[model samples]
Target: MPDAYFLPDYRTIRYCLMKHILHGFTLIEMAVVLVILAFLLGSLLMPMSEQMKQQKIRNTQQRLAELKETLIGFAIDKGRLPCPASTTNGLETAGCGDNTEGYFPWRTLSLNIRQDAWGHPF
Candidate 1:
């Protein structure tokens, strides 16, 4: 066996141990970090989706208010309320006595709106 004098000292042993430990993060550590990042991103996205839905609702409400005002203005101008529009086209019908429910007369009103915020007919 070699003499004790030829063996590695305690300082050399400690240096080698620290070098290996400081090489890089382990696979398990990387996976844990990725999971934490995913959780953070998911939390942020949920509220953003909810905010988008709220904005759509607000837009729909504003459009409905505008339509009500426009209808009132039309009644004052023509001395009578406009007739409901036909299903095939958005034009006002000649007679409204038979129809209780129908499309809005956007064409006759000279309005460009054809649908609501959710892509449904006004």
Candidate 2:
């Protein structure tokens, strides 16, 4: 048989492959990216947290007002003030502690029981 075609140089191919293998992020670079992302996310979440707090405050105010109206209606219908509840669960319908006050839940109407976000009583 006659001489076959000469093969291309393998060294160049190996060098290019090595370069490609080295061209990627190191562990340190990946860690830095993660840290930056965490910082960005934390900063963004702060404002959202504040907004959520304000929303909660407004909701609490509205709910308290509604509770006040309900208590007033209950009193008018039954001819007595709504009795104070032992807790702030807001679902007490059978009076609190004892049956002395005609089954009125008043814990929702107390100014001292309710508190603002700053931990002060409403």
Candidate 3:
């Protein structure tokens, strides 16, 4: 008197316990919806990472004001101001007199990026 093929009656154990309690989330509600979607994707990526670090510090202050107006238009077309580079081949340096610092000749101002905006140099 208890063998409906094997024995699962009472309306199939109350419809398999109401289809496993409505069949859904419950590992603490999917870990509280994955911790509220990782706290809403970390508050929307923290102001887009501080607006990409203030657009890389305003693109390194507009590339140091276009390299100080290309070194004042190469000292008004080469009347003076060149020499600086030569940390072993960035050019320039025929004579910065008593070595007035160095680096930034950008190949004697023909320009082509020596580095900046985080890479350093320049």
Candidate 4:
């Protein structure tokens, strides 16, 4: 071994240890990373949510079209527009049955309306 007097530099060793200790992430660094992640996630999800909404709208419109076609067909079949029934019994009533309830044709067309993706009156 070299002379015992030639000891390693403790100051440099302490400096290197301190540097390593201070090299960890700071609060600001973590906050910045979180902010970036949030932005990326928001950008990714926004288009997906919008696409889902558009799909729902398109599905609703398609269902409405089909309902209109069924209504027209029913009219042609009976030579008149469908009328609402007195009750769930599917009997014709004084006025048109609740078209909104899908009972205009004695609930026969309810299946068509229910097929819509959103399953709303529209």
Point out where model 2 deviates above 4 Å: 1-25, 77-79, 86-122
TM-score of 4: 0.63
Alpha-carbon RMSD, candidate 3: 8.7
User: 11-118 in candidate 1: lDDT tens per residue?
Assistant: 989988877776655665888899999999999999999999999899989888888888999999999888888673779888778546788888888887778888
Model 2 residue 4 CA deviation (Å) reads: 30
Model 1 misplaced regions, further than 4 Å: 1-25
> Per TM-score, what order, best first?
1, 4, 2, 3
Using all chains and alpha carbons, the TM-scores for the candidates as numbered come to 0.73, 0.47, 0.43, 0.63
Task: State which candidate has the highest TM-score.
Answer: 1
Q: Candidate 3 — worst ten consecutive residues by lDDT sum? A: 1-10
Cα lDDT of model 3 by residue, 1-122, tens digit: 55666765688789888788766536668888999999999999999999988997888888888889998988898777887876935788775786488788887677777776677887
User: Candidate 4: misplaced stretches above 4 Å?
Assistant: 1-24, 84-106
lDDT (Cα, tens digit) per residue for candidate 4, span 79-110? 97766544555544555443524343436544
Could you give me the TM-score of model 1 versus the true structure? Answer: 0.73
Positional deviation of residue 90's Cα in model 3 after best superposition, in angstroms:
10
Q: Pick the candidate with the highest lDDT.
A: 1
Clashing pairs in 2: 85-107
Q: Write the per-residue lDDT of candidate 2 for residues 1-122, one digit (tens) a residue.
A: 23434665688899888777666546658888999999999999999999999987897787578667876777788797655544554334554454453322445444333555555433
